[model samples]
Target chain A: MYKVKVYVTLRESVLDPQGKAVQQSLSSLGYQGVEDVRIGKYMELQFDDSVTDVEGTVKEVCEKLLSNPVIEDYRYEIEESAKQ
Target chain B: MKFAVIVFPGSNCDVDMYHAVKDELGEQVDLVWHDADNLDQYDGILLPGGFSYGDYLRSGAIAHMSKVMAAVKKAAEAGKPVLGVCNGFQILLESGLLPGAMLRNKNLKFLCRTVELSVVNNETMFTSLYEKGEKINIPIAHGEGNYYCDEETLAKLQANNQIAFTYASDVNGSLSDIAGITNEKGNVLGMMPHPERAVDNLLGSADGLKLFQSIVKHWRDSHVVKA
Candidate 1:
């Protein structure tokens, strides 16, 4: 079994309005050295023993549905799970 | 003309769309569930608003994958007019039927009000009844109406006259104040404003009714030729 952790974020060229609003509030609260902030989504997927190539599946899913190619980018890490 | 309003599980505006078609426009319309795949008989397709899939990942992200969308794409490719409003607009963007993606409104607030829209292109099937440069009132209700696209795509949209409507004033911080746009073929349209809700004077403005009328008029004109 493999456990995949996927992270998705807006591309650098795209603006993150929510993240910007949060950053402003943080700065007003006196958190110094805050250069930038961008909001994103993270998901953990569990692949069963039947799945042979974890990386291939993760990449396909991310590109096809998880992350929108026009505005967002995603990366994932795969780790072998001992449970299954 | 026959119209199909694709209803996703979390869709809240399906009734309004049906009302606009049957009651206001006096046309044949059906509310097709997302799971249904057959839409070959429909002359036009409508994707109504509200939070599809509760807009979890992004607005319209989940609903775009419905089984019915395959038929929607086929209709678009076959040159059938497809109209998407609000969340429906987001779904069209995610499906790549139209270019550009939506971002949260710059103010990060859910704005609900009637906004004035300037008709940017009237040659398309959706706006043929509207006069060029005519200003109309349409209600907009959403959190993610801010439209974004790369400069290259923007240039292409401009070149092709794909822009359908622009806000008379900056309402959601959309680039160039774009309120609605159509595909290059001009068969598919996606807009943040709710034209279906404005089909009658009781709802404050009847300017939206002409849009539906225009779709039927164009479809009837072309279909009659084949017969």
Candidate 2:
């Protein structure tokens, strides 16, 4: 079995409103010198080891379904399961 | 003409869309489930606003993969008018039928209010009834309606006159103040506003009625016998 860990974030060119809001809240809470905070998403997927080209398949899935290329970017790490 | 208002599991605007088309526009309109196998009988397709799949993965993300989306895509390729509003707009973008994607509102709030929209391109079937630069009142309700596209795509849209509407005032902090845009062929339109909700004067705005009229007008004009 393969365990895929994916991270997705809004592109730098696109505004991160939710992240910005959180940054403001942090400032109000007495944090100092906080430069900026950009929020993102993390996803995990499990696939059977019978699958080949695991990396390539994950890449295609990320581009097609896991992320919006127009506004977000994504990268994934695949790890083999000890059980399988 | 017949219209199909696609109803996803969590779609909230399908009924409003149906009312606008059947009672207000005086046309045949039906609510089609997202699992339907075909859409060939419809003259136009409408994807209404609401949280489909409870907006699980992303706005319009999960719904784009629904069974009926393929039929909707085919309808678009067949040159039938396809309109996506609010969540519908997000679906169109997620499906890649329209360029650009949506981000959270700049204020990070769920905004639901009426705003004025200026018709940037009145030549398209969706806006032909309105004069260029004409402002219409429409209600926008969504949390993620900030539209974003690359500079190159923006240049192409401007060159093609594909931008259909711009908010007279920046209501959602959308790039270029864009509220609605059409595909290269102008048959597919995706916007953040709810025109169906504005069709009745009882709701305090009938300005959006012209948009429905424009669609009917264009369809009729194209179906006419050539001289």
Candidate 3:
């Protein structure tokens, strides 16, 4: 069995309005030292032991659906589970 | 010409599209479900606006994977005209039928209003009825209408004359003020503005009606023989 975690974020070159708005709110709340804040998505998936290539499967899902390559970048971490 | 208005879950503008083609343009039209895999019968395909799949994951992201998208892609490859407006445009971008992806509006607000758009390239089948550089009023309603693309893609789009319409003034902070663009072949168009919603004078501006007329005109010119 395997557990995978994926993080998808807007590319640095792409502007993130939501993140900027949050940053402004933080500044208003007196967090003057915060220079930047970028928003992103995190997803978790569980796979059964039958799945052989966890890394390949996670990459395929991220590239094909979870994140759009045109404006977003994605990275994933996979961990093997103890047999039940 | 027969047209198909693809209806994905949460698509709210399909009826407007259907009405524009059927009643306003006097053409045959039907509302097609997103799960259908065939789109060979339609001369033109319309993907309307609305939060598809509840805008989950991202606007148009989930909807792009629907079964109907394969048919949409097939129709586009077949050289049939495919028009996607607002969320529909987002779907086209997500599906890779168009070059750019949409970002949240620069102002971070859901904007809904009519704006002036300049016809950048009138030679394409979708804008042939309008004069070059003509300004038209179209209503736009979306939060993620800010279009983004790499510099190389922008240059290519410019060189190929694939840019169809640009906002007269910056409305969404889109790159190069691009309001609409067509595929390299000029057969598929994805735009933030809702032309279907402006097809009648009662809808505040009939400027959008000519777009549908232009599509029909092109189809007739190519497929119908004048005896």
Candidate 4:
């Protein structure tokens, strides 16, 4: 079995309004050193042992569905576990 | 002309689109489900707004994968008029039928109100009835309506006059204050404002009615045979 973890974030050039709001709240709470906050999504997917080319599959999924190439970028890590 | 208003799983504006087409424009129209496989019979296509698929993954992201999107693409390729509004616009961007993508509103809040929009280019089939530079009032309701695109795409859009409308003021943090834009071919338009909601004077403004009229006028002109 393969477990894949994906991280999707807005492109650096794009403004992150939600992240900005969070940063503002943090600053108001006395965390003056919180210079920035960029929010993103984290997802996990599991693949059966029958699937081959796990890396290719994960990349395809992330590009096609997990992250929008226009405004966001995505990266993923895969871990394999032997059948119990 | 016949029109199809595609209804996704969470679409709430399908009926509004149907009413605008049927009662306001007095055209034949149908509400097509997202799972439907064909849009060949429709002369024009409308993708209405709402929280499609509950805005999962992202607004319009999942809904763009609906079975009917293939037909929508075919219709677009065939040069049929396609108008996607709000969430519908998001789906268009997600499907790559339109350039750019939407980001969260700069305020990070769901905005719902009428705003003034300047008609940037009235030459397209969708805006032929409106005078160039005319200011129109359209209702906008969405959380993720801040449109974004890279410099190159923005340059291309400007050069091709694909920008259809711009907010009179900065309503959202969209790059270039873009409220709506058309495909390079000019047959498809994706906009954040809800024109359907402003089609009647009773609804606060009838400024949007001319847009529908424009589409019909253009269609009639082209389909008419000249001797």
Candidate 5:
């Protein structure tokens, strides 16, 4: 088994609407100095395959389908998990 | 042309896109789920609209990191045409497949209505069917569809004629009233309107079908007949 984590965010230079909305709400609630806010996502996955090639598999998946290299970016680390 | 429609968890328009591609162009089409990684099989990829992941975190932000996105990136890099509609547009922005980002409608309410879009550029794979300066009505359904970008990037996009579609009227306060944009290479396109939903006259208008037809025609014109 392998555990994987996915992180997705807007490109560094892109503006974030949701994040800006939250920042506006925060300021209305008496917070300050929040120059910018960018929204992102995190996902955790557990794969049942225990093949000898783990990292390469994860990387392949990440590069091929797991993350959109355009606006969102993702990286994953794999660790062997005990089989049930 | 062979086509594939990506179906993320909250993708609502994958079937519509599939039918639009198949019924309109009579092309081979497939529904690719978010978990699949291999997309080298298709000639074109369509990221359909919908509230992926229930619009959690942000529109398209969660879906951007899905496994299928990796395949999307590869297909795009290989110069295959990719189209993103509505939430799919947001995903493209979140995924960095296209520049600019989505923001809440300036009115702070979900806007669902027909919108007028002027064809700013007719040279992209997605907009080739429309004549330059032509105006078409397409329905938009989204809470966060306002597009924002820095001035420098916006200027560059404008200079390159990458702005494919612009709102004829101020709809969501998108910067420069941009409704759709194409990548510099014209292989990737993202628009915040639900073109697939408008492909059939039964649904509303058939104007949207022109987009799919354009993509198919371009592929055939470039690869099959030309070759």
Candidate 6:
């Protein structure tokens, strides 16, 4: 079995409103010195032993539909896991 | 004169869009669900603004994989017009219907206010009613409305006149202050404002009504014989 972790975020040059909001909240609570916040998303995909070439397939999915390369960036990691 | 509005699980602006088209154009409109498969009957499709699937993961990430998206793609390929607003814009980015993606607002707040938008391009079917550089007021309500694109693509958009609307002020951190864009064919438009909510003056402003009026007039001009 394989576990695929997908991290999705806006491109570095893009502004992140959610992350900035969270930073403001933290600062309001007296946690200072925080700067340059960026927000992202994480998704996990699990596959069984029958699947082949997990890395290539995940990369293709990310490029084709999972992520929009113009405004967002995505990377994936595979891990060995027990079958369901 | 058939129009359809796609409704995801958590779409709050579907009805507003429905009424906007129905009342303004005096046309029949259908509210299609996200799970529906067939989309051959509609002349146009509108993806209204709202927090789809409660914006799980990303604003439009999960909703991109809905069963109805296949139909949406087919319709788009057939040259039918598709308009995506706010959360709908996010879905268009996720579904690859349009370029770029939505980020959180620069202020990180759920901004809900009337904003000034300047029409950068009026060649699209969506913006044909507005003159180029025309300033209009529309309401924006979203947590993630910022738009980003690479420099090359931005240049391409500028060169091709694909940019439709831009914010008049520095409200959101959109690249080049872009608030809306269209596909290469100008049939698919995705923007980060709620035009449906601005259809009536009683609602707030009526500047956005011209957008829907443009679609109706375009359809008539394309199909109806002028005397």
Native contacts recovered by candidate 1, as a share?
0.59
Q: What's the TM-score of chain B for every model shown? A: 0.98, 0.98, 0.99, 0.98, 0.97, 0.97
Residue pairs with backbone overlap in model 6: A17-B104, A17-B105
Report fnat for all candidates as fractions from 0 to 1. Answer: 0.59, 0.88, 0.94, 0.94, 0.06, 0.82
lDDT of 3 by residue, A1-84 (tens): 888999999999998889999999999999998889999999999999888888898999999999999999999889887867
Q: What is the Å distance of residue B123 in model 3 from its true position? A: 0.4
**Docking model 2 quality class:** high
By TM-score, is 5 or 6 better? 6
Tens digits of lDDT, candidate 4, B1-227: 99999999899999999999999889999999999999989999999999999999999999999999999999999999999999999999999999999999998888999999999999999999899999999999999999999999999999999999999999989999999999999999999999999888999999999999999998999997767
Q: Candidate 6, which CAPRI tier?
A: medium
Model-by-model DockQ, in order: 0.76, 0.87, 0.91, 0.94, 0.10, 0.58
lDDT of 1 by residue, B10-29 (tens): 89999999999999999999
Candidate 6 error regions (>4 Å): A5-11, A15-44, A64-67, A82-84
lDDT of 1 at A57: 89
Across residues B1-227, which tens digit of lDDT does each residue of candidate 3 receive?
A: 99999999899998989999999999999999999999999999999999899999989999999999999999999999999999999999999999989998999889999999999999999999999999999999999999999999999999999999999999999999999999999999999999998988899999999999999999999999999
lDDT of 2 by residue, B1-227 (tens): 99999999999999999999999999999999999979999999999999998998799999999999999999999999999999999999999999999988888889998999999999999998899999899999999998889999999999999999999988878989999999999999999999999998899899888999999999999986778
Instruction: State the C-alpha lDDT per candidate.
Output: 0.94, 0.93, 0.94, 0.95, 0.84, 0.87
Superposed model 1: Cα runs more than 4 Å off: B225-227
Q: After superposition, how far is residue B29 of candidate 6 from its true place, in Å?
A: 0.5
DockQ-wise, the better of 3 and 6 is: 3
Q: Which candidate is the best by lDDT?
A: 4
User: What DockQ was computed for model 1?
Assistant: 0.76
* Candidate 2 runs further than 4 Å off: none
Candidate 4 residue B153 C-alpha distance from true site, Å: 0.5
Residue A43, model 1: lDDT of 98
Cα lDDT for residue B157, candidate 4 = 100
